[model samples]
Target chain A: MKIKTDKIKKISKSSFTIYGMVIMAYVIMQILVSTGSLSSLMEGLLVPLCIYVILAVSLNLTVGILGELSLGHAGFMCVGAFTGAFFSVATVDLITIPLLRFGIAIILGALAAAVFGIILGIPVLRLRGDYLAIVTLAFGEIIKNFVNVIYIGTDKNGFHFSMKDAVALKLEEGGKVIINGAQGITGTPNDSTFTIGIILIIIILFVILNLVNSRAGRAIMAIRDNRIAAESIGINITKYKLMAFTISASMAGVAGVLYAHNLSTLTALPKNFGYNMSIMILVFVVLGGIGNVGGSIIAAVLLTLLPELLRGLNDYRMLIYAIVLIVMMIFNSSPKAIELREKYSLKRLFTKKTKGEDA
Target chain B: MALLDVKNLGISFGGLRAVDSFHIEVEKGQLYGLIGPNGAGKTTVFNMLTGVYQPGDGKITLDGNDITGKRTIDINRAGIARTFQNIRLFKELTVMDNVKVGLHEHYKYSTIAGILRLPSYYKKEKEMNEKALELLKVFDLDKEKDFLASNLPYGKQRKLEIARALATNPKLLLLDEPAAGMNPNETKELMDTIRFVRDEFDMTILLIEHDMKLVAGICEKLTVLNFGQVLAEGNTAEVLKNPQVITAYLGE
Candidate 1:
């Protein structure tokens, strides 16, 4: 019984550490902005940092927890961005308030992405590791390109859709083209603030960490460790797998909504919502150490910030990024590095302090 | 009526007759053993019983309910739980969490309840934690409850597997080679544990074992199979004394 409490306490403490880290960073960034120390370029990146953090954490759920590599997360984000942007654009006049409208848009975006996740997971999850990864990669690219051909317009006839150019919709006067195919949706309200992004990160952390410690989480992890044993123990393999996948995709969708609301224009480009974006999120998960949520959070922040910080070194920007990735890989995973890290970890210091109190 | 009854149970891997017309009956609280030489298809029978493999022929009834060829999860829910010969513990999960996973169906809470952490989540989780601890205690593993299953020594891993199996609250427990890798001391302790589990849980057990002493000591009844056919089925001592069984074990 005492051991159980210690375990629970340990879980909560680690979670608090993560929360503390985020809040501390927020305060420091705010201080920098107020003192005019941070550049205008760095300030622009505040919201994007939140989006990448979210993407990395959600992808960790699929790759680390569910033990399935999903490279099409960007596709779900693409779906969310377009759908949320469309909702906001279409209903701009109907809903005058930004908060209520963006809230509903986030929900709409998340639901759309979850639907796609279910559709993809139902078939693709049947395949194991490499095949699933390849299929998801293809799906990510397909979603990006698929959005490029779509055209939607709002008129008296109530939303015209066309696979061709925006002109094919043949809109009447005063009708608005909300989605201009590859040009994408523009005039989306910039509802995202750094504060809101931080709050969302807290919520995601709560949902994910809570889920991981619960009975459902244990069942999911069991399936990951040994599928046959989990089945024999009566865990519904498909249900848990689909649950984790859909939840992850939904979180990615929320991140997408956040991203769309932060931008004046939302586009499903190869660089933004394509396979490259998917791989970037995956690198955050992998380099952060799979299943280590806090590590991924830090990885997302550092990796996102590094490119900007190294912007002064134009010729060697990506080179520095690559070197950092390799170094982080070694530092996070190598046995000797782990030993050194633990030997000097803040956790150890805290433990010693507590032990002294106990003494 | 038997706790578990199988008649003419068979499965074929394409053209190969893996287990041909197998038969066994385990009464309530009986310690039944299935023994055979390597390649005698012992594990195949276990697979069929646990719904890992659909039987090519015959019926499987547990507590008089037909559970033939159900999915593995369904069969477990229907009161049959099993452990693997190779010790398929959830290696990454803590010992307590591993057992808690087996108690999954018995504990009632939705994914939403878990995520939002409603009052019921605390209530159920506390109860599960206590119950899982009680199970680990039964295996003398309560101390290592927080350790990952992979970090456990070999013998404890085997015991943890059984503890996980029993956590399902199954009426019958199937152990595939529970003593496969145990030393003599560990094997003796395991024998005591199997007997204690049978008595304490009122469990009907069917185990596959290569350890002759373990089989002869704990098993009240024995079924010997050779080349997918049941060579003999009777009292443990009588089966061990049979010349054909000896021949099957040692060969001419």
Candidate 2:
């Protein structure tokens, strides 16, 4: 029966075209880079560019799909990065022990990030839009600050701030050793490459895409559009919002891990995980068009490379950014774009229909 | 037995009783219309029935199942569907997508399956799409399947809301002022559509409407409220002629 069903499906065709297209895109990207036509700046931006695309798209699941604005998205990313980085460093010496060490670390990092996402999502999700955003923003700041105060090792006054020494101190403090205060965890193993980062980003992107198209996702969108109506229709608004938040944060965590391993250092500083980074990531979504995954990726990659392209005009770069954003917002928000898009699509649709009938 | 039974359902906001000792019992397959002047607590009764507010005192039952004080979603899951007076749609989504949302309960594929694009997810998704399209077609909305809901005109938007509610396969559909802003022609068309939906879906309906002619035309039974209490309840024609309902509407 299964064989017969499979055969029948193959005969009619399916969305195999989408998968084929995805493969073609990857091939095209690789070819562009390898042929040197993509430019060094664009190439250098690709890895972080891909990661940000995943982050922005995933955040959209919370902000757009779930219809709840989140301002502390980077906090989840931080959790993933630190966890992934810690695992990689701890298992660097065990590289000769086959895939067990590296593989385990990646899985552990992703899981740790997911767990933290759940923990953080539960409390703040009760609040409405602006309140939720503010709470999440505060939570991110708190997490960064908390990491800063972690005392990893003690120097020489009987105990010091050190990862090496924390192993022993943990035994006495009942496994409560601090990593170190504000110094950031140094000597992190640099194991993340473009391949792994891109792969994980793809995985996260696929997850987010699926979620937004799911029953749960539709419920979230309904709440965003009309909360009262959604409630009247029997959608568990709170549950779905929290689910979106947690899933988004988990994806951010995966990106964080990739970021930490790529950067080869963890700085428990406000500057590293600041509000600026959060806004920069959000700009990708807004510029790309909210609830649009493809647009988000395009925007992330383009925006990531924009600064590099304007590196020569460093003094006036920010001013240019502001102007571009303002212009885009003015054009995007007005009914003109919507009207134009509708007309264009309608025209195209009729033309296609007429052509098909004529043939 | 009453399909929806509400007893002593009252809600107080600070000093005033917004809805006081409101009571209603709607039988199966009943086309019940609730009418009242502004602040007469018609909508408040609907709210309490659907779990928007926990009544100061009340009990509600559906099919002999006690569902008092359940969350809105929980009450909905128990086979009650409702539409707002102000048409509420997923504005950014397509009309077909909006209908698909109402068919959410049927999609059983997990998030993992959906993300991985597993065969089951694909199959379920295909089925869902078909169902959504079918729903749109039922309401003459198939032509506007891809149009963003907010772009739909007023009358069509109202039709879309009813279509969406019916997609839930509800046992009892509640429409809160479905014809508030509609023209006479639209209302006439709507009266026909409401009857068609009720007969086709074999569902009971509770509607809150202010238009006496429209209410008297379609609703088999009527419940009139005045100042948070049931002023009149009987067959539509009989109840409309009642002195209490007349006095309440005339501000006597």
Candidate 3:
């Protein structure tokens, strides 16, 4: 007898569609770049675009799927960036192969960020709504300042750490300083390429999509939809919340690693890994349709490129950007638009048509 | 031994004793009713039993196991599952997915198996879907399985909540105000559904309701509370006729 596996099949089918879209977009962009039709600006934007996509998707796991507001997502990213970049820098002389070193760095970076995720999540997850958001916002600022005060140097005597000042380290002969307070990590190997970014995006998408379609994902969503109901139904709230939060943070760390390597010099600045950055990622999730993973990818890519593409507009760029955001928000959520969307949704396209037909 | 027993279950918010020294003992396959006027601590008792609120003083035993002050999820796993007074269906999820959430604990596969979509995960998920569908069919919600929970009609939403709770396979089901806002017809239907559920599952059921007809129709036993204290307890006919219970409902 043929057992009904319709849910699994449906999930796999939608997942395939998302995967196909990502790969198709990547292939088309690759072709354009290889054909020299894409401008250098657009070319440079590719890696950042991929990074933002990962950031948006990961943050969506918390903000959308988990239904918890968090503003410290970039703090996790900062952890990943600095730790991954540091690994790369420290091993630059030790490991000759860039690919292998970067692979190790990415894993280490994700682990570091996940650790921070757990630490912050345990205390902060206990808080709800605006309180959670505020605490996470504070956490981001704390990490930024904490990274600023931290100073690391290396020499034949081994690594030295000092928070007061870099000079207090008293390094041995030929000692090299990696992190200079405020100046951030400089002279790191720029090993991040668009291909690597695409690979990471695919990995992130694979994990997230599979997770969302899985049992744990449903439990997490159940918690999001109705915490009391979820609890009464025997779902372990803390376990699912922490699971999604840590995974979300780890993915953000992966993005951070990609972002760090992509840059010639990386810093834990407010503009780079701060409140504004966190808000931007949140905006991606919101504008994309909360809990809509595929929408997040599109939103991240489009939003990332919008400002760069509007460079010709100069002074009016941000004004136009704000207008577009307002327009998209209205279009995405307005009742009439939603009605139209549901009526013409892709699922409706495939199902047997019954509307407007007599039985 | 009773299938479920509660003694001295009490909680206070500041100076107010919301539920003071409340107690009930329910036998297997019995349909029990907890009735009280608004704010008489009927729902509060359900909250404590389900562990939403830790009773300042009380002991809850299920099948002779102490479950007092346990976390809500642990209490549920320990054979007590409940529904909210207000329907709490996962609004964004499909009706099928909502039921599957209740069946999550029953799936034996590891999370790694789920993420990787191992053969075991598919097998378990298929079983889960079939079981969820079967529960949905029981409530006549099978046809609407793919619809979002929020999109269901108000009456169906209430039914879906009960169906979802039942998916947890609890030995003792605690339903808070299941017939709260239903019309006469819907309430009548709900009464029948509750009866069918008890007979089919052979489970003990505890329900809080202001609907006197529903309470009197199905409950084999009744506990009436007023001012955070039990006003009367006996067979349904006897409790419903108690002077204090009548005064509490009709006022002095």
Candidate 4:
């Protein structure tokens, strides 16, 4: 019991440290903004940094913790982005308060993506390893391509969805097209702010961290390690796998909500919601160290900020990024490096402090 | 009634008869052994009893309820917990967490409750920690509760698997070669642990072991299988002395 409490203390302390670091970063950024010390490049990247961090964290749940490689993360993000943007656009006048509208939209985005998650997870999660990865890759592209041709308009009759161009909508006078196919939703309320994004980050962290230490989390990890042993112990394999996959998708949706509101035009672009984007988030999870929550946050922030930070060194930008990626991968995963990390872990400092008091 | 009664349990792997006409009756609080050569289908019978493979024919009764061909998870929930011949610990999970997973069916809390950290989550988790710690102590694994399951030594890993099995609070515990890789000292200690688990937990155990000494040491009843057929069944002393059983083991 005593040792268990110590373990609990260690886990909670790590969670607190992560929370503290994020808050510290938020304060530093706020100060930078107030003092006008931040460049335009950084100011533009603030909300995006939050978006990538959320994406990295959510993908880590699938790729890192759940032990499944998923390439459809950006697709779930796209689902959330479209649904949230559409909600905000449709209710522009109805919801005069931007905060209220965005909040509702975030919830709606999560639900929509969760539904899609269950739909995809049921059939696809049954296939393991590279097969699941391939299927999710296909899904990411399929969603992007399908949303590219989806044109939805709102008129007195009702919502009209068409695969053809906007002209096929045939809207009445004063009626407008909400989703202009590949062009995506426009006039979405610019409701996203750094504070909202940070708040969402904290909420997402709270949910995922708590889930990791819970009974359900144990069951999920057990399934990841050994399916037959897990089954022998009476864990419902399908239920927990779907739970992890669906939750991961919904969190990606929430990240999408933040992303959609930040942009003036939310489109299903190849750049934003494509195969490359999913793999980008996955890179963050992997290079961060799979299953390391704080590592994910750090990797995401550093990787996202690297290109812009090196804007002055245009020719050397990607060269520097690739080198940094290699360094991080080695530090996060190499056995010798792992040993070094453990040797100098923060727990050592904590234990030393306690030992001093004991002496 | 026997705590576990498997009658004529059999399974075929395509054209091959892996196990045929296998039967065992383990009364409450009994230590039973199923001994056979490597290819004698001992593990196959263990698999069928624990629902790892659906029996091609026969009935499995636990207490009084028929549990034949139930899903592995359902069989575990029905009071049958097992360990594998090859250790299948959740290698990544901490040792205590492995046992806590075994306590999953008994403890109740929704995933939402877990994510939200409701009071019930705290209450149930605390209960689980206490119970898991107790099980670990039984196998002298309490000190290593925080270590990863994969990091434990081979002998302790076997004991940890049994500890995990006992956490499910099952009526019957199945151990597959619990002493497979143990040295003599570890095996002797293991015999004590096995007997203690059976007595303390009031567990009815069925084990598959190639070690004749372990088979004769603790198991009160013995069943001998060779080429998918039971060659002998009776009290441990008599079964071990049976000419056919001796011939099967010695290949005479």
Winner by DockQ: 3
Off by over 4 Å in 4: A1-4, A312-333, A346-359
Q: For candidate 3, lDDT tens digit of each residue in B101-220?
A: 989889768778878878988788878888998999999999888777887888888889989888998999888899988999999999999999999888789999888889989999
DockQ (0 to 1) for model 1: 0.53
How well is each residue in A217-322 modelled by candidate 2, as lDDT tens digits?
6777888888877776667777777777778887887777767766656875655576666777788878776766666767777787777877877677557667
* Candidate 1 stretches greater than 4 Å from native: A1-4, A312-335, A338-359
Interface RMSD of each: 6.4, 6.9, 4.5, 6.5
Candidate 1 C-alpha lDDT tens digits along B149-248: 8778899999999999999999999999999978999999999999999999999999999999999999999999999999999999999999999999
- Each candidate structure's TM-score, on Cα atoms with residue i matched to residue i, is 0.95, 0.87, 0.95, 0.95
Model 1: which residue pairs collide? none
| Model 3 pairs in collision | none
Estimate the overall C-alpha local distance difference test score of candidate 3: 0.87
Evaluation by lDDT, superior candidate among 1 and 2? 1
lDDT for A260 in candidate 3 is 92
Cα RMSD (Å) per model?
3.2, 5.3, 2.7, 3.2
